[model samples]
Target: MKNIVILISGGGSNMAAIARAAQKEAWQEKRGLRIAAVISNQADAPGLALAKNLGLSTDVLSHKSFDSREAFDAALMACIDQHAPALVVLAGFMRILTPGFVQHYAGRLINIHPSLLPAFTGLNTHQRAIDAGCRVAGATVHQVTAELDHGAILAQAAVPVLPGDTAQTLAARVLTQEHLIFPQAVRSFF
Candidate 1:
């Protein structure tokens, strides 16, 4: 069976959704796909527990323990390689990967960004979009490249920015879409 390794740094809502879909669809038996493991840089990340509860294997390799970005990415890559993942999914994995790491995964690595690509490429994407007075904000599932969020788009879901919407509210709506599309994008590879 082909394995999928997911990386997360926060509350792994997207990770949970993908795992759930994998379970419901029986990807292993049906499509030769299995969510082999979920790895996080934060030991206290809530998603680790959630992943465990979902019957998925989980691990933590704290980034704080590493001396530099390259060191951390090297260790992270080691942990991920253990799973022999066919695809590496970044579900809220909040770290800037080194170019070597990105090149190692290449087409196999993918991420779900909170805003439309080529627009908002970094953190605080929701607030940035709001501050820019954008009428539409969305999520993009794309390849993970060295140049931050400037990867090839795989799938997208756009949400309307309602009147008087704060970043929190808009994020909530966008997250709902993220939960949907991220899984869809993962399943597409199989």
Candidate 2:
């Protein structure tokens, strides 16, 4: 069976969506896709508990414990390797991985960025979009690359930035689209 490992840092709504989709679609029996593990950099990450409830293995490798980004990434790589993941999915994983770590996973690594991408590459994307007076806001699932948020997009879902929308309201709508497209993008890996 092929293993898919998810890395998350927060509530992991995206990770939960993927797990739910895997179960609903019978990915294990149909595509030989199993969620081998869910790893978090923070021990208290809510997603870890969700993964546990779903019966998926979970681990935490706090970046704060490591002396440097490279050191932390090395340890993270080791943990991920233990699962022998065929694919590494980043669902709100906050760390900026080292170049070596990104290259290690390369084509097999993917991420779900909260903006249409190429537009808002880093944090505070929703607020930036709303400030810029954009008409559309959305999400993108793309192959992970050395450049932040600059990868070959595999899938995207666009939601209109409604009139008089605050950053919070816009983000909420985009998040809904994210839950829909991210799982589909993961399934496409098969």
Candidate 3:
């Protein structure tokens, strides 16, 4: 089976959504694909427990343990390669990947950003949108490249930015759309 390994650094809500979709859709039996593992850069990441609860293999290689970004990416790539991943999905993996690591995965790597990409491409995206008085904000699933969040768009879902919306409220709506479209993007690969 072609393995889809997910990397997460937080609660892994998106990771759970993709894992659930993979299980319910029987990706392995029908599409020759499966979620082989879930790896986290934080040893205590809550995602590890969530992934285990979903019955997917989990690993942790703390980025802090490494002295440099290059060292960390090298080790991370080694861990990921062990899973034989055909696709590597970054769902809340908060690190800025080294270009080498990005190139290693290349077309196989993908990410889900919180804001409509080509707009808010970095952290604090929701608040930025709200501050700018954007009437609409959404999520984008895209191919991974050396540039941060500027990758090729795969699938996107837009959510309206209502009046007096705080960042948290806006993020909640965007996350809901993320849960929906992320799984769809992954499924499209198979």
> Please, what are the lDDT tens digits per residue for candidate 1 over residues 62-163?
989989999999999999999998999999999989999999999999999999887898999999999999999999999999999988999999999998
- Give me the overall lDDT of model 3: 0.95
lDDT of 2 at 116: 93
Please give the clash total of every predicted structure, in order.
0, 0, 0
Worst 10 residues of 3 by lDDT: 20-29
1-190, model 3: which lDDT tens digit per residue? 8999999999999999999988899888999999999999988889899999999999999999999999999999999999989999999999999999999999899999998988999999999999999999999999999988988999999999999899999999999999999999999976
Q: Give me the runs in candidate 3 sitting further than 4 Å from their true place.
A: none
Model 2, 17-107: lDDT tens digits are: 9999999999999999999999999999999998999898999999999889999999999999999999999999998888999999999
TM-score of each: 0.98, 0.99, 0.99
Q: State the C-alpha lDDT per candidate.
A: 0.94, 0.94, 0.95
Cα lDDT for residue 167, model 3?
Answer: 97
lDDT of 1 at 93: 95
Candidate 1 regions with alpha-carbon error over 4 angstroms: none
